[model samples]
Target: MRLNAENIKGMLLRYIVAIVILAALFTLPFWGGRYIVMLVMLMGMYITLGHMWNLLAGYSGLTSLGQQMYIGVGGYTLAVASTNLGLPLVVGLIMGGIVSVIIAVGLSYLLLRMKGMYFAIATWMFAEAMLLIVATVSFLGKGQGLFITEARKLVTAQIYYFSIVLVVITTIVIVVLLRSKLGLGLFAIRDNDSASATSGVPQFKSKLYCMIISSFITGVCGGVFYMSQVWVQPYASFSISWTVAAVFIVVIGGIGTIAGPIVGGIIYVFLSQYLSTLSQIGSLNMVILGVIAVAVILVAPKGIVGTVQEKFGFEILSARRWLGKSLAKVPVAPAPASEAERES
Candidate 1:
């Protein structure tokens, strides 16, 4: 038997995707306005973060409440490396990811033993502890925190490009991982852990893998997220806002599908950005989002993508089809009438 790896169609498809996404990214920062670029970056980060949390909480059935711990660690690592250690912002971001991995291993060990509500509470408690610790540390300026001192000189265009690259890489990694055998195991576990275990899926290991992957991506996102702001503080970095926002996106987008997070994240970011200006009722934005999430879950528990799959036989999560949409018809786009036919 011969293996089929580098088929022409696959290679061409990959190349086209790469070119289109790259062209869009490079052209956007150059021609698009500052707010537009910012929105793009926001969507990228939201997609990555939402997907990360979804892997652990949604797919692997892990109820982690303390994802902020990794995010905070990554944020602080970036702050310390860039400010105190005098490293370049880029290098500091890498260091942040490396440090976050270490922290995640330890925290996972501590909390993975707990299940359900216990697991959720443990995660929350871990984040609270991190927040308190960072608050009291003088070197991190206690509550005041660190800012990228000379980073103002860095070009915004460069940051935008970097964010685009990060999103591209994250999307690729997620797609590949989800298509692999392990992704199959995760699905099984998510649906029924005991059954998957009985069938030899290694449920615990699969869950742990999901947690680590989710942590690593989310941690790196935190690093990049802070670098974008050029500042890091305990209150903001460790804020439950990350958790809340990610949760909302996953819930709204369709928890288990690849397109869910991306679609949901974009919607959440734009909606929040626009609705935040209204203060008549005080935080009506969150209230509205919360209500919407509840309604979506109750009405369409599978989310937009999931519901589409159930109703329309869509396969948006397939690895070969990145950026898959769930809508059934491609909108036949009215075939332009032939010139002669129109005349007749």
Candidate 2:
């Protein structure tokens, strides 16, 4: 609860490292090739999506397979808002997240009732249903989808910078949340909801809060992605592949840790990109990726970051409890007893 000297040092170190990395990434467009910038932008999008999904599934224990629902909702909302309202792309991006928040609020009641495999199935069903619904709506382009004519005119540099800004915003929000009391409650619930409830954690409220935040961020990512693509189709936007990618990256990187998703995203993107170049494998790249994921799970169930931290005692983004335990381990002299007790 209190920011001790060690905590302050850790905070400063974390911020310094983040600032340095951001400074380097921010200058990529100036000297880096255009293709490299685009590739980085794509990585940023996946990182944001991975972070959002990890917050809910990894930290909150709410494994949703329908995150694409929000992604689709966000993408469609951006397309509509920009086309119909004549809003700026920035405004549409904000609107996309807001619309996702609204949808999450309405969907939480029913979805939250289920648990385990049942919950997963319900989410997938919901996403499919939404895809069908969106496909039938003329305003949403009736499956043909909608394109943001205005966004199409924007250059890749502008889109790449915007993507970076969104990723940074999402990372900051997640880091802040994970350091708060609510974040502790989230981790507690993830470990054991019944125990957490007995210990005064509000299970439903914490889960819902995580869901809303995750959905909003995911929605924004979707909007940015489609804005850059210049088009959105129900089949592609709402494809379950988005969720699969999130789960794969999070699982491979280390679930429930802030650094995990980013590591996972980078690894997944690079591996996928490299595999795609192999002419022999071609369409079988995903199969190879799946094999690797399985191998990682079998060898290191905690994922890359988690395994490294466990083995090396590293704490780049350790939880508060982790820091507390480390601090507790340090030897300290016992305080003198009360004067009356000493006299006695």
**For residues 1-344, could you state the per-residue lDDT of candidate 1 as single tens digits?**
12245555665886898799689887997789989998888888888888888888878888677777777877788778878898887787777777777777777777777788998888888889889999999988899888866456666676776677777777788788877889878888888888998999986677777777777778878887877888888988898778888889988888878888888898998988877766555358778889989999999998887788779975664643233221221323456899999999
Candidate 1's TM-score: 0.85
Q: How many residue pairs clash in each candidate?
A: 0, 0
Residue-wise lDDT of candidate 2 within 47-94, one digit each (tens)? 999999999889888899999999999899899999888999999998
Cα deviation in Å at residue 252, candidate 1? 0.6
Q: Report lDDT per candidate.
A: 0.79, 0.89
lDDT of 2: 0.89
After superposition of all CA atoms, the RMSD between model 1 and the true structure is 10.6
